[model samples]
Target chain A: MTDLSYTSPRSGSRTANILLRWALYIMLGLFALFYLMPLFVMVITSFKSLDEIRTGDLISLPREVTFDAWRTAWSGACTGIQCEGVRPFFWNSVLIAIPAVLISTLIGALNGYVVAQWRFKGANLFFALMLFGCFIPFQVVLLPMARMLGLMGMAGTIPGLIFVHVIYGLGFTTLFFRNYYVSIPSELTKAAKVDGAGFFRIFWSIFLPLSLPIIVVTVIWQFTQIWNDFLFGVSFSQAGTQPVTVALNNIVNSTTGVKAYNVDMAAAIIAALPTLFVYVVAGKYFVRGLTAGSVKG
Target chain B: MTKWLEEHMPKLVLAPSFIVVLIFVYGFIAWTAWVSLTRSRLLPRYEIDGFIQYDRLFASPRWDTAFTNLFVFGFLFIVIAMILGLILAILLDQNIRTEGAIRTIYLYPMALSMIVTGTAWKWILNPGLGLEATVRGWGFEDFTFNWLVDPDMAIYTVVIAAIWQSSGFVMALFLAGLRSVDQEIIKAAQVDGIPTWRVYTAIIIPAMAPIFLSAFIVLSHLAIKSFDLVIALTGGGPGYATDLPATYMYTMAFSRGDIGQAASSAMIMMMVVFTIVVPYLYSELRTKDD
Candidate 1:
């Protein structure tokens, strides 16, 4: 092992470095294409006419662009008895995600505030229990959850779905907020307490404002998760209230008619758009939330 | 009274969520175990029968296929994703000019749901509509890549889709781990005349063993719980060729109207998850305690 630093710097070494750099670039570039290919195919196929799509290769550019598929996918594509396309279901997802994200983030913030700042006798145990929720296979809970929903007479409803998402979502959201809040000095809360601020008062004035970053992480995470969830959306909600993912699945899996490849691709893109939009617009926080929630939590 | 109320407020604020977890997470697990022991169909019944449901579940060929597929899919998915993720991370760790853009491209897939991943891959792999047809149309008349419809090969298609969705996530984790490695250590290795690849192989990677374990734990659990991906991609079709445990449980619970079978399968899935996760949790918690 000759020390490069101790040896005279050589053009050969520099060339080897440059070559290695180029090799890395090329390999990374190829994988980038692999990652982007399905998306490219989805977008291009969505834009192509059915005939053009049939005629063209999977990776070929469409001869003529068309929004017919997008239009049908959004407004008129049939999903079983529903011929109203994915619009209603998309709204259903929006409806479910908003309250679920809000409620879960809020509760998670409070939970984090308590567990991190206002530790009690069983705080660590409670936090541990909540954290365990993050790892349980949702399948394990599905049967009983359905039964619980039925017992409560909230089965197959949007509210029921929201309840389910919020319930399961608390683990991750709480983890995010707790991890974030844990880094904040307890002196802030202690000072507020010294000034006679109660728990809610301190949370409202001190913790909440300081919580903007974690809230963003939690909201983005919860929104993306609840929005993209297919299992609960499919299992807990009926046809009229099914989320976009389930509708998209039904539309794609529909066997009654000829497979509408173009429409299906368009619908897939449409279903993916909200999360993708969040990823593009707030991708930094999205990734931060992901890394924070997983790596640290 | 004020002092008492103040002392109790945190617990009260935390009570609802705590109770929810108590019932939903822990209690439901118990209930599910109980249901597994009962002879229930379509709807649950309370009469406890012995291990009949487990016996039936073990006997069913669908369950066998589902268990086998779970192993195959989980093993391939975790290994491929980790390797791809490690490679991508190492490459990106080279201080490339386009690292951010390339990383975003790689990670954007993770933001999308498995349903979207499955649907896109299903179309891409569709025999008549996707890769095979397109290749044939390009005058590669001998070409055949119809795994989507090929019963024997359909499970691999699911693996491919799962890898696509998750590898980027794993990459992000490893990239973070790579970045957090001490620059001094690398410089020390370089000054010691260690080859660059050898330095990474011997020093940097070994230092990130925790990240590797964390990534493995996350990936394994995800692989175990995969449901939407299989549903959106194969629907466990070509006659139940790609039925992972999650989908198998869903079918038994919902479509097949066998509550006992569903509960037993669900319990088994939970056991699989517990086996993977509880040890990880134990280690994590023990470290935290220390």
Candidate 2:
């Protein structure tokens, strides 16, 4: 958020107007604090020792910043079910998310290309069918999907989770690509067709190259959705395959012995880092993805 | 063969995904619907048994609590988030310095998973140590803010965390909408000596009905599907007090071994979603043709 300062001109006497402007800034700042204070608290708390956490206040910066909590959170915190920490689960998430994101984005691009440029009979209807998948509660599919995964011998496996993600993610991915591809003139495709191009040829040579922006949006969208997922992670996954969100929940919510607040906070932050990194760096596209994914066409 | 393959290239390319959606999405939904109608216990029994599971679901007090919690959580979360989002957007719309920075701060939570948000809030509201202790330490002495454990208030804690996560995204939406409002109309209102607040209330806000609806749909859908947040924040506890339908369904099928009740609840959830979304999709598609 750059501060180029294009403050809309307001109508008031000088004293009143300046006061109002100050009040607005204060209010905005307060809200910003409200939004940001948790992340700040999480960071500071993650560094504090359990003694300091027990002794100090929530808003105070740690007296002695330590990485021990992070180490414990990353490698050895007991999550009731296991004591190896969220490291394995985090890797499980990475394993699930990378392939899921890639496959979903690739298929979504193709689906989008077909719907937008290579419209065949009933493509829009099929596209609409796919779009409808976006809104279906995963609960509705849980019973059968579990059964289906079990039948396929992929139940409680990383590939099953990936398959589930890719299947559900197709809607948003396809929507992104189709909407983007539609903005390009069809003449490009037609010209290529006249010059003896096949379906994958024009798509690979033209549409795929032209789809970088939408691809970024879709990848970020898919990555965040897959990485952050807990319902699917918990439902379909067994002991070793759960995602970090599930593992983080287990670590934080575990009722065993003395609660490790610092470790819990560190584990939470560790789970949050990837998505937080994406938001901070590519926030503009993240916002674009939200808007694109939300508005139905 | 080459000619046939060339002619069918587009269809060939699109076939797999089409089949996947057909079976995975549409097919599984039908399967769920079928399962919901059966008397399945620990495992699925495919034989039809009518709406007996629904009778069981509606009869259960836990489901009742979960159903009621959905409305309370959904209403408060959606309403407060939109109100706060609109206000933040309005403030940021003032061309203030640091608008970009404030906007970034506000929207950063959206990128995080609900689970992360839940965990952070869980820590923040950790009964004695987090908010209550911090506030009491400030010499308020009796300033009790233990919503995290109170069964009645646990849902509201979920609402608060939800608002924190989603309201920023709403702010972004409204900010975009505010920025897109016709400049000429605002200028004309200003030229006519209308106050800024009136220009907003009487014109700008009214023109954003579409945005409000979109936000409402998004927020409500999220509310209905809110399982992860509750799972992390309260674990739908203080013992099922924070349970929404999603969690209820999960508990019944996975933990409790009451697959019939789970399937039925899942159907009801889908029905709720369809009622909200079908109309919205209809309106959107109808308008798009023009």
Best by DockQ: 2
Tell me the lDDT of candidate 1: 0.89
Each prediction's DockQ against the real complex: 0.61, 0.62
True lDDT of residue B198, candidate 2: 83
Q: Which tens-of-lDDT digit does each residue in A200-224 have in candidate 2? A: 8898898878778888898999999
The true-versus-predicted C-alpha distance at residue B73 of model 1, in Å, is 0.6
Lowest lDDT 10-residue stretch of candidate 1 chain B: B188-197
Please provide, for model 1 over A106-160, each residue's C-alpha lDDT reduced to its tens digit, 9 standing for 90 to 100.
9999998899999778999999999899999898899899989999999999999
lDDT (CA) for every model shown? 0.89, 0.89
Say which docking band candidate 2 falls in: medium
lDDT minimum window of 10 residues, candidate 2 chain A: A1-10
TM-score of 2: 0.97
